[model samples]
Target chain A: MNEHSLTAEIIAILRKAPSVALFSHVSPDGDCLGSMLAIGLALESLGKTVTFFNPDPVPAGLTFLPGAERVQQVLPQPKPQTLVFVDCTDLRRVSLTPDYLRDSIVVNIDHHISNQRFGHFNWVDDQASACAEIVLSLINQLGVTINRDIATNLYTAIVTDSGCFQYSNTTANTHRLTAELIEVGLNLALIHHNIFDQKPLAQVKLLQAALNTLELRAGGRLAVMSLTLEDFQKSGAQQELSEGLVNHARSIQGVEVAVLLKEVGPQEIKIGLRSNLWLNVNEIAAQFGGGGHKRAAGCTLNVSLAEAKQGVCQAIEEGLEIGRDH
Target chain B: MNEHSLTAEIIAILRKAPSVALFSHVSPDGDCLGSMLAIGLALESLGKTVTFFNPDPVPAGLTFLPGAERVQQVLPQPKPQTLVFVDCTDLRRVSLTPDYLRDSIVVNIDHHISNQRFGHFNWVDDQASACAEIVLSLINQLGVTINRDIATNLYTAIVTDSGCFQYSNTTANTHRLTAELIEVGLNLALIHHNIFDQKPLAQVKLLQAALNTLELRAGGRLAVMSLTLEDFQKSGAQQELSEGLVNHARSIQGVEVAVLLKEVGPQEIKIGLRSNLWLNVNEIAAQFGGGGHKRAAGCTLNVSLAEAKQGVCQAIEEGLEIGRDH
Candidate 1:
């Protein structure tokens, strides 16, 4: 079915359902949490029983969203008439795939290019910078008024997903939508500060430790860094704190490929790879049974930190050499 | 004069002038450089001779601008028909006070709240997020068609000054103008990466050293970090790498006030202060014979680094105590 017809059918299903359960991916981010909460609140306003579900609590940085407190980790015993997933590329990514969810009608909404379309009704728009943007359209199709709270939630989703509109995914529509959201009395300063500026001391400590071990390779074309388990323990930082650390390596001038080896276990290490120019880190990561976008990708190795670092560096070197030949 | 009449008057002046010399503040940022270039290009398109002037060469990051290569550091011996200050808050900020400029008609265009209106004709609109936005208006007033190069320059000016539209200064007009700029074939990703993401390895090294010295004080409400000349030498980082280091301190959770001390000489230290909440660092900076906005400000001390740190910490502690009492 065409997108217009699919949107209309989804709206019809939502309106007729007496109760709806909204789910987002595990380890929920601002886009998923905000989009889910905004839709859940809108449905509740329409006199429909609505429940918000996530595999985990919202990230502390994003708990400032209006309905963030209502996000439940445990799905209610009785399933709702309609089960909707927001921002999940695949149903497996939602984390809580119980038998009950299978019995209920599934609706999938996402913006990821790799969406599996694993739903009875699927609406995926990779062109959208954030799933919250798609939800904005969904809310409009449902003929519900977007209150200030809803506007704030969706705005946070878009802003966070777009990296405050600095990311390449951000488009003219992104700015226009953000402009509309701003008109809804949202406090841009407070939101931007909470999401971007505020960071735990532990995270800064981790960043410092990571930067201390930074090494340049391939005549400064390849940059690599590693974080031992001891470093993490000393820093007292969560694994999530290392999320964007690889970007630091990739950001260095003259670096085409950046690799970060993070020891997650005695014999297990997770590797993050980022490319600034033409090198495809995704292909390299895919060789290790991992996959992601062309510029950013990851893989896990069950080996000592030194072995993992050596293996990844070799792979990156080979990749760069091949790219140069091409 | 009303803003409309002022704009019309400025347009008339630009049309009548056979030659125009454009100038921006010293140590030009993206906003000043972008604004100056856009206006200079627009005036040039009108078949008028335009000379762009700055005390220093354009910053490296902003050198990607189309006409940046033509920006002259030394002013030409002959004076132009009109002397226009693009983004200078005051005439003195332009860094050129030659006798020839003193006799020329000065047109001041700026968006700073503290602009002194020190010109024969002043056009200061603090409401505009960037001076480039006002230049866009001037281009429109002059009936000059905005080509791709002009749009890209103005877009970079707005994006940088508004912190890529994340700062509170970003408004609906900012987004609308950015959207228009994007329509003119502006590569948002390249501009954003150049301005924000791309950083030297030296900068990351400097950040690591700064974070190593991060200290929590006043019950973690005041966070402070300092970098001595030795740290600079060890890191092999330039002085400019410390530009946003104070923000690292401010980003710490529960940090109401953050301070960064950079030892420029044995007895000279420059201090940067950032406030997350109610404390006005500007007032604190004023006490140290410096000034800036309420949240972000700076000052320089000619005392030993230790003394400077002690004095600044005491001022911050007192400010916090007073704020709590109030």
Candidate 2:
């Protein structure tokens, strides 16, 4: 994330556009989905005909948000209007529906530093724990009604992406936002369960597969695993199953580092990384042209699954060394 | 629960006693442990000679609680002048040290309807979520410091035992207590993770094993599974790994009910029962002299493993029938 006055940029886009379609990365996560919905909700409250958009199925875990069902598939039929890309840094994230933004007024909002400024107006804050944080600030500036639903939705975005406010990226502003969100009557347990406890059978099957394949190294200080499509198919699982697997891997005893290499396709690997209390995973993610927060981050690598595992293990080793030296 | 006024009764015992020991039930869960420790902490804070006694090892998950390390194993020593059994409704719970309370001023504080009134002063309120809730009320009556650590500890106790406040037992008072605890800066994530997120390898392994054995029945509205000790041994998992395994079984799309029968010993079985949003598991647990809230409850049976499984499955079928009938 790189700092820019997102408020100024978003306001300029709103002034120039009459309607907007909001989109985030494919295979949307809580932060991505919640941020998209939170922004759409804000704009809707402002009397805009805003259409929330995404190409992939909203991961099952984040389905409870109030406006989640209205989040439509990003079909290229919203008429040449404003396309607000959220939580997506690179165009590849929206590859399936890249044309959705090709001829539209693009307003990009994200928190990944690797985000290329592909939009007509780009506002990426690498330091913010979640894009919802930026969106919250904009909502505050616009002075909209943040009812309990909106407050809970924003809280879900920030809390999940920030590892529930314990991650290093939890700036002072993060806690302050949490306080404000709770003030709006977000039942803490519902927010926690809607995002965490509600997992589909496929996700459970996938986690079982990952646990079966977990390889402990560094005398148990590191936990590594890879999930292939065959494993996914056999388990009847989905890619979203791999979402929190890395964190589970990281919880192993003495496992200061955890890595999960998910096979997107034969030669495509999406790496998810997590650490105990330390370990800078963002640097590792960036080595593969991806970027996220330090303690928990990820990247994508265009290599065979086997090769991707080797590269990530090497990167993890180097990251540990770099962390140790510093 | 039911507007308890046990403060005077408990204080009366303390007034006549120079030494006191607070013992919790065997196979202590968060509520049992929390009631033991929160009471122990409040007593220690009040300059009482209190020893937290237990018959089993503190379950691996709750070791993060403040007084966990201090919860000593019962040994041959002088008995306290006053003895308070926190969560034990039956004397068999603290049966490991039989004569330990024979002549001691035994006081039973519990929330179980089946409580046999096994002590001189029995404060049993079946309406309460747990004994910890009672202890928390007592702490409030005593006007203790209720510091962040204590509040956090008490909140964890209440949250875990109360199904994170989702169980039917949750009342305005429960919410009021929880709100006060959180308002006192009890970190919600800390409580959530301490009880739920932190899983051991064997537990994960047991989960995988349990899932492996999962089979849907009754038109997929019921799922059942088992965990043999052999499964735990293969995974290097402890008995504690059995926690939450049944919930996974119940979370399936068509599953209105779930049952997990874990072989605790050669013949004895520890059965876990869970139901979806529309089922009652408490009645099933009550058949075997155990009690829990609607969604989750369990009971142990000293029978052949096969018999235990059959008995539980039959009970679930009956419960499902009743649920359907309603």
Off by over 4 Å in 2: A1-198, A233-238, A286-289, A314-326, B1-5, B12-18, B75-77, B96-106, B119-127, B163-179, B182-198, B213-220, B224-230, B238-240, B259-273, B277-326
Model 1 spans with C-alpha error above 4 angstroms: A12-18, A96-106, A118-120, A141-143, A283-291, A301-304, A307-311, A314-325, B15-18, B76-78, B98-106, B141-145, B283-291, B299-311, B318-323
Q: Which digits, one per residue and each the tens of the lDDT, describe model 2 over residues B68-145?
A: 998887742777778888878788887744565677778888988888777777778787876767777778877687
> All candidates' lDDT scores?
0.87, 0.76
Looking at model 2, residue B296 earns an lDDT score of 81
Clashing pairs in 1: none
TM-score against truth, every candidate: 0.91, 0.67
* CAPRI rating of model 1: medium
User: Residues B104-152, candidate 1, lDDT per residue (tens digit)?
Assistant: 7889999998888877789998889999888988898899988988988
Q: What is the RMSD of candidate 2? A: 7.1
